[model samples]
Target: KKKKKKPRGSGGGDPGCPRVSKPSDDLQTSRKSGFFSALPLRASLRGYGFCMAALFLFCFGSLFYQLNGGAPQILQDIRHYLGKKFSLPRALPFPSQVVYNRVGKCGSRTVVILLRLLAEKHQFNLVSSDIHNKTRLTKHEQVDLMKNISKIPQPFLYTRHVHFLNFTRFRINQPVYINIIRDPINRFLSNYFFRRFGDWRGEQNHLIRTPGMKDDERYLDINVCILENYPECSNPRVFYIIPYFCGQHPQCREPGVWALERAKQNVLENYLLVGILEELEDVLLMLERLLPHYFSGVLDIYKSPEYKKVGNLTGTVRKHTPTLEALQVLYHRMRYEYDFYNFIRDQFHLTKKKIGLKSASQPPAYSSAFLRELTLRTPKPLDEDEELESDLEDKWLLWCPS
Candidate 1:
């Protein structure tokens, strides 16, 4: 058959020879190859879509974060991460030294109670002085006291009924200072009643505390005390709150513009915070925020059932609200105090706002004429002479043990 054509896979070729594919087989092979080849492209397309979606979400999230003022926080966190990752490590000083030259009758005892629990839990030193009688000290005494305070181990909180002690003035490292104050009239009233009847400690406790008190003096009507201008209810006594901030200057004990201004300046410069006792919860919240080392969880402690029971047990024995006329007189007498109180309240609200807490209202911005108005309100012509400390009983000397 001459060189007749043989089948590709069979014939006179070697038995091991490979077969050549037919057109139909080629078509099937091409289809399989095409299907396998399309898999990679399809996978790549899915990956690309996924990346695009992720990018879109990232961009949207960034925009939303920026709108919510979270961009700076993100940037800060990134910077912090980078700094920690790449920078040479350096020890940062923790704020460990704190001073609470606590004002008397300003819920300090309650704070102390909470502090006692916190100190036990947090393992920090809490030095609460038992001495309540002396707030002012001689230069020598101040130096001695500052030395003593500085010698306390680090991470310590020293609290006492004392005026502001300028450690820097004596070349000692100044500790962070915090304080709480009450409405001046309210403070006066509290002190006034506390001296006479004591707290829930019982009347016998009061008798032992004030052995020299005459029945008339002890039972004196509060209205008479304010209206009749009793020495205890007047100037230097009402002048009380400012001196706790105004330092140990003898003049600080007097109620005058100088003392008031000095107290304000000191508060601005030295105090980390000057809270109002009326907003005690807010005060504690701020404390927790500003001094987490010492005051963390303090609010919870204050709200605990055990703490509430203690508070009730230690409440003022007899609190009398003065007659409206007496209250008005007391208010006028405490005008400077009211001014300081208003300032502290405004500052407190501003701080609250900064910390993302709601305030009933923002304080009005003071105008340039504030000084003139302040002077007019003081009315120096009406200011009487503040009596000597010895002339009146010092009700601030009262301290109920916790």
Candidate 2:
């Protein structure tokens, strides 16, 4: 080519240079390689961020649950599940705040477990049953306690063996109240046995132990303690269940129609339900039918103690019918308790009739129908249908008549 001498100097190009057939392709390949080289760094950084976020969440959740005195095992899992899939309806017909004034020896163990289960399912904070502090609290201390209770997070489920008080003193938001009642005789027997034997589940109930009945010598002769007016059992009036449903007033402890009337009035007006231990299945089924969001098969709480392992549920033993003397004294002393129990029991039967339950053995009609519907609609293995899940929730949410 006459040696590159004939190259025209149109620009800075060297005419002797050979033109590459695919320069653009080579450049693209180099750019792609550079991007691939950076991929690992980007991935590691994202992973690190995710870990840090999860760690922060775990710590915060633990502290919140501890301070609230909670179902520690449950809240964490629920918090995580709710973070990604919060399904609580935005337009609920009622306030989500729940106050379970848990009464002792009233199947409260199973009730608490059921409550914790519901709390987890519904993504709510479940406060521990920490009302052991209720006894002997001064007015100042009571005020402080109420104030502290008010400060806890909202949409909270507070469970306490604490008696109902005029919470208006604390000026806190009113919550939906729920409680359970047991036959006064049975409750007294359970309390006596639980205190004497700790827990039937082979666990000690340190919080509920009698004060002077600590040592083995004292525990051996618990009868003496009772005869000597021990706070646990000396009181013949198993006034235990009375204070729970009524406000703080002298009449609450009185054994008369006034007390029963007041307690029953509170039951009919304030409480969502006052479940009976004898009819626990009906109670749980009724709860599921009325407040499905707060209950997911609570009967499982009783049927399986390890359902969540939060409660001390165990098998039943035949209750020893106290001698006629004991029953006579108990009836005379705890006359109000008997009346209240009778009132509630009568209402229970009336309610059963209203809900079409001719016998105590009958399951709630709504829940019976719902279970059949659910079984029919449940998806088979290897089948994924989101609409079906939504429909299930909708079915459970069928408008419950007040």
Candidate 3:
């Protein structure tokens, strides 16, 4: 053994040599084994990163799709794949051909009735807002509604309580634009009574006590006061009248002046049609002429006894003297709207004599019985069956792949 040890030093006794010791052989084996062991972990980590990146890409794509009203199949596939990967309700399509600017208490309900009749009579593809009780929606809500409308396939009609200027950018060709206006003074008063008394049942005596409250707060009960006094508020944009009486956004710099100019321009530029609430019968006549196939002989203007005494204040004390000051304020505020309305009235040949009624005529023909009939016929709690069957059919056709 001593002779072998001496020989080992000269040949390969160096501690650093791999063959010199058993420990060195064990170290090399451990490193080689560990290298293969870590291979699966490294591959798994790469796969996890790839999966994360793919998931991120999918989420980003979905967000963009949702913002643009989603893909056409989104609504169609909702029933099939709702509980799986994508679980959101589909957005309903809105008609874009017909635009209805519903001015409150201006016989808008009658206009809605006529639109429904037109839809039924012509069998034209149409869509009406789901507004059952509320008169107006917030501006942002209206904008969102319009965005949803923009996604619909064209060649369709829609009715809603929207401002005329709100839909100017829709780029629809030869779209029918219709609205109703009323005598400003009478309109204001009617709005007041409805808000204060909750119908014609409220006492007329409350007019004087109304001034004590701020203009905005005073008309809480009256829808008209809210519309008229909206301009005076710090945020005039909140009012429903802002789009119609004020003008389009960004162009509404000077509320009083710009609104008037814009209103005038809108009336001139578009295929705008006006209906005087006071001359609703004549309005029906004009509509019959314009949409002959759909509306001919459809308007049943049944005169009501209640409307006969609408403007008769003989027995009631004259509490609000002329209400001229208030009227003038509103007229000046909405000068452009008033002027444009007057011009439209003249153009349509809707004078007092032509309509066969004084400014003091009874409530619109459909104010009583027609409304009652409509209320009974339409679905109560509007949302229950607001699913328009025709609209759905049209949407299905639009969504069909080419």
In terms of lDDT, model 2 sits at 0.59
lDDT of 2 by residue, 1-402 (tens): 465556664354777676554788899999999999999999999999999999999999876643333445475467556755976543332446667777877777677766766676565567764444342244565576566656655556667666675566667655777777877766887666655556546445533455555565434443443333344443423466776776666566544566667777878877777777788777876665455456645666557847745453453333345543444444444546766776776777677666555544533322434334434543321211111101111011111111
Candidate 3, overall lDDT?
0.49
Superposed on all Cα atoms, the candidates' RMSDs to the truth, in angstroms, are 12.7, 20.6, 22.7
Higher-TM-score candidate among 2 and 3?
2
Q: What is the per-residue lDDT of model 1 for residues 1-402, given as tens digits with 9 covering 90 to 100?
A: 689656555555865688766899999999999999999999999999999999999999976753343334456467657867999543232577888999888888888888888887555778878777678888988998899888877678888888999999988999989999987777888888888898885768778767899999999999988778788777666777888899999888877789889999998998888998878888887877677656767877888898898877566778979876676666666777777877888888888887777745433333326434544544322334654333222232112212
Clashing pairs in 2: none
Candidates ranked, most accurate by TM-score first: 1, 2, 3
lDDT of each: 0.77, 0.59, 0.49
Model 2 residue 116 CA deviation in Å: 2.0
Off by over 4 Å in 1: 1-93, 359-402
Q: Which candidate is the best by TM-score?
A: 1
Q: Write the per-residue lDDT of candidate 3 for residues 1-402, one digit (tens) a residue.
A: 465443344355674554445788889999999999999999999999999999999999876654333344445355446645576643333223555656766777555555554555444455666543333344655465666665544534565554554554554234567677776545555554443443332464455434355555654433333334443211232222434533435455334556566665676666446767766776766655454433444444223434334423212222232233333344444434444555656755644445343444445322335334433443311111121212211121111111
